[model samples]
Target: MRLATFEHLGLRRSGIVDLGGDGDDGAVLSPFPEGTDLLEVIRTGHVPATGAALPLAEVRLLPPVEPPSVRDFVTFEEHVEGVRRSVDGTAGVPDAWYDAPTFYFANPCAMVGAHDDVPVPPGCHALDFELEVAAVVGREGRDLSPERARDHIFGYTIFNDWSARDLQSREMQVGLGPCKGKDGATTLGPWLVTADELEPYRDADGLLRLALTAEVNGVEIGRDLLSNMSWTFEELVAYASRGARVRPGDVLGSGTCGNGGCLAELWGRRGDQDPPALRPGDTVTLTVEGIGTVSNTIVPGTTPVPIPSARKRPRARP
Candidate 1:
């Protein structure tokens, strides 16, 4: 079943999307209640259709859940290698990357809906988008083993990790961040597809053999198979849960895919003449085979607030 949150009749509600309903564009059914918290529904695991079904076209979709936390992992070796080459002129991935699934915490408060407008962050020129898949945690777990991690996942959603590449490059030079470079905006939606709905696409090896693709304006930029990940979602979740608790509504991203997931990777491979960075008015759309698509348009950013610059302090005598 696909779960979603949408605005209908000037009120926010949670419901199940019925793609084959009597309406011309299907309908949204099983609405929990007006102002219902979707995250709480995921925790209880009970979704009842107590309200009337609304025509899908009449409702504006929102991010399915307001995730409490988001952990995005770099699980694709090709992506890592390409990005490293672009940033460091190196073609090989770090040895540590192969040892474990490395990740970074993203700002949940910065999330936007599937079709919302994303602003190009202030002081950023090299804007980019990462095509990724994210799993939403349904059950709470701590120090989980990879084998037992699958049960904790509730559903999947397409993730667009919007980036400010120029800012990212400058910040990482000091060895510690992608913070402001990435926190500007992140996209999560279309809807959340329950894990069981995707069982048909799951291979015997436990990899979800879903096809993923990205496009800008109307041209296809990159495509890849979800099976190409170096590590599984289970492993990523286990790693995230190590010594910490993963609760319902927490999100775990499958990172950027290879074969052109982002413009940075494309730039690294073909140089700057080809695919250009995202600009205001450009639209980015990402499609995951079974889960669906999330598209957002770029808009101009707000002017930044002025701040005092830091200065060096004199050394004290020992």
Candidate 2:
């Protein structure tokens, strides 16, 4: 079943989406009460589709859930190799990356809906979009083994980790995770597909073989398979739960796919001549097979506030 949080007649509500025969002319069946928190419903694990059904086209889709926390992992070897140069001026994947799934905490409050407008961060020029998938945690668990991680996942959704490459590169120089460059915005919507719904797409090795694609302003820019990840979602989740906890409403992203997932990777591989950076008015769309598409239009950002640098202080006697 596909669950969604949408707005209709100026009221935000949670419902179940029915994608008809062609997967376009669908309807939303309201199960929970109006103004109900979708994250709470996911945590309670009870969804009853017994209310009125409204045309999907008539309502505006919102981010399925307001996640408590978001951890984005880089498990795509090809993607790591492609963007290393642009990120840290390196040409190869670091050895430490192979030892475990590396991830960074993203600001959950910065999430936007599928069709929302994303503003390029102030002082940013090289805005990029990352085509990826995200797993939504449903059950609480700590120090879980890889084999038991799947049971804790509630569903999956398309994730677009919008980035400011120029800003990211500068921050990475200090050997720390990205901050303002990434906190600007992250897209997560269309709808959430239950974990069981994707069982058919799982390969023999238990890895999802979903196809992912990204486009900029109606032009195709990136394409890759989810099965190409160096570490499976279970492994990523398991690694994440190591000495920590993963609770309901927490999101875990699969990072960016390889072979044109972002313009930074393209620039690193094909030179900075083609695949231009994102600008205001340009729309970025990411689609994942068996899930759905989430697109956002770029908009101008507010001017950054000025901050004074620290001044040197005289040494004090011990």
Candidate 3:
């Protein structure tokens, strides 16, 4: 089932996409609560039905989760090769990097929904896009073997790991990481397709042959096949949860895939060189074969409200 958590007419609910019959008949069918995203719904096992089954068109699609916990891994070899080739002459996996899987936490708060305008932060001259697949964890587990990892997955969704190339390059050289460089913008979903629906495509390699593509303002920019991933999802899950428990709703993102996954990989584009790095009017769309497309717009950044300073509290009463 293509499940979604959405708000329509001020009412929030979770439901399976009833893409049956006419294309215009799409509806969100369950009534849960505001925070009822796909991961939460699946963990319960009881799919709740909604009122009036709000037609999908009128409702605004929010990020699959208002606040999503994201854990990203660089599992595709081709992507690594492409990036290495771009950054330097270095190519192929360094033995130590392959000895065990490694991961990084992308921003949880940067999550934006389909059609939402992703902000291109001020002074960031070079911005790029990454096309990826994400696995949503359904049940919490620790030391889960490869055989059991798939069972813990709830579903799959698309992820766009937007980057500030210049910031990332400078930060990585210091060996600290692309902390502020990466925390800028990351996006997910028009909807989250459940594991049951994606099961047929899942293989021993856990690689699905999906045609993935990216376009800027309707112009084709990048394309690749999901089958090109070097490491399988099961391997990543096992490696990630070796000792720590991966809880339900914790997202694992398949880092950027090969070819045009990012500007740095596609072209030698980096900061200052590109005059217009994703302005307010630009739009980006990423599409995976089985799942639908997710499109987002670029917008000017707004200063987030500052948290008021806390007042010194009076002495507490005995």
Candidate 4:
């Protein structure tokens, strides 16, 4: 089932995506409460079959899972190599990178839904987007074995790990990791498709069956088969929990994968490229094979304008 968190009639809710409907006709029933988002649903370990009514197309889609408890390793090799090539002139994944699956924390408060206008923070001129696949944990357990990893997975979603490359490059040089660069804006979903529903897309050859793509302002920038990933989702999960607990709603991002995955891969150097970093008018669209598209527009920030004092106002005409 493809589940989602959405806003309808000014109230937040949750439900399964009804692909059969033109607008409101096909949404399957799910009983969700007011302001119930994906984070709440996943935490409960279940999704009911009824909810308040709304046209699926009319409602705005939020990240499939909000404020996930844990986010695990980024295991895509092409992504690592790409970053290394751009930053360190190295073309191979480091031995340390392979020693264990690496993980990073993404800001839950900054998570945004499809079609939402993302705020481009001031002084950040090198905003970039990363196309990735993220999985949510369904059950909780510690030191999970590879054979048991699949049992812990609940669903998958399209993720855009929006980045400030300039900041990222600066921080990584100090070996402190990606703190400010990665947490800016993490995008997920049109919906979260359950693992059981993706049976047809799961292959036995250690490759994901989905075809992924990314476009900026209607221009295609990234495209690749999920099969290109050097590491499998199962491997990522097993490695991540080697000696730790992996809980429900723990999101495992696939990291950026292959050519055109990020600005660094698309353009060799920062200023060497012609097009400016993502601007206010830009629209980013990320689409997965079975699942639909997740899109967001960049907009001006909401800094309050200064109000003139009453003393500066002219006296009202009597």
Count of backbone clashes for each model? Answer: 1, 0, 1, 6
Give the per-residue lDDT of model 2 (tens digit) for 54-169: 87878888899999999999989888988887777689899999999999999999989999999989889889999989999999999999899989899999998999998898
For model 3, the stretches where C-alpha displacement exceeds 4 angstroms are 21-37, 66-68, 85-93, 268-276, 302-318
TM-score of 1: 0.95
User: Which TM-score value belongs to model 2?
Assistant: 0.96
Q: Best lDDT goes to which candidate?
A: 2
- What does candidate 3's lDDT look like per residue over 64-142, in tens digits? 7543468888767767766655554365666766766568988888888777788876456567778998888777788
RMSD in angstroms, all models? Answer: 1.8, 1.4, 6.2, 9.2
Weakest 10 consecutive residues of candidate 1 by summed lDDT: 21-30
203: Cα error in model 4, Å: 1.9
Per-candidate Cα lDDT values, in order, are 0.88, 0.88, 0.73, 0.74
lDDT of 1: 0.88
Quote the lDDT for 208 in model 3: 76
Looking at model 1, residue 11 earns an lDDT score of 85
TM-score of 4: 0.85
Top-TM-score candidate index:
2
The lDDT ranking, best first, is 2, 1, 4, 3
Kindly provide the TM-score of model 3 when superposed on the true structure, using C-alpha atoms: 0.85
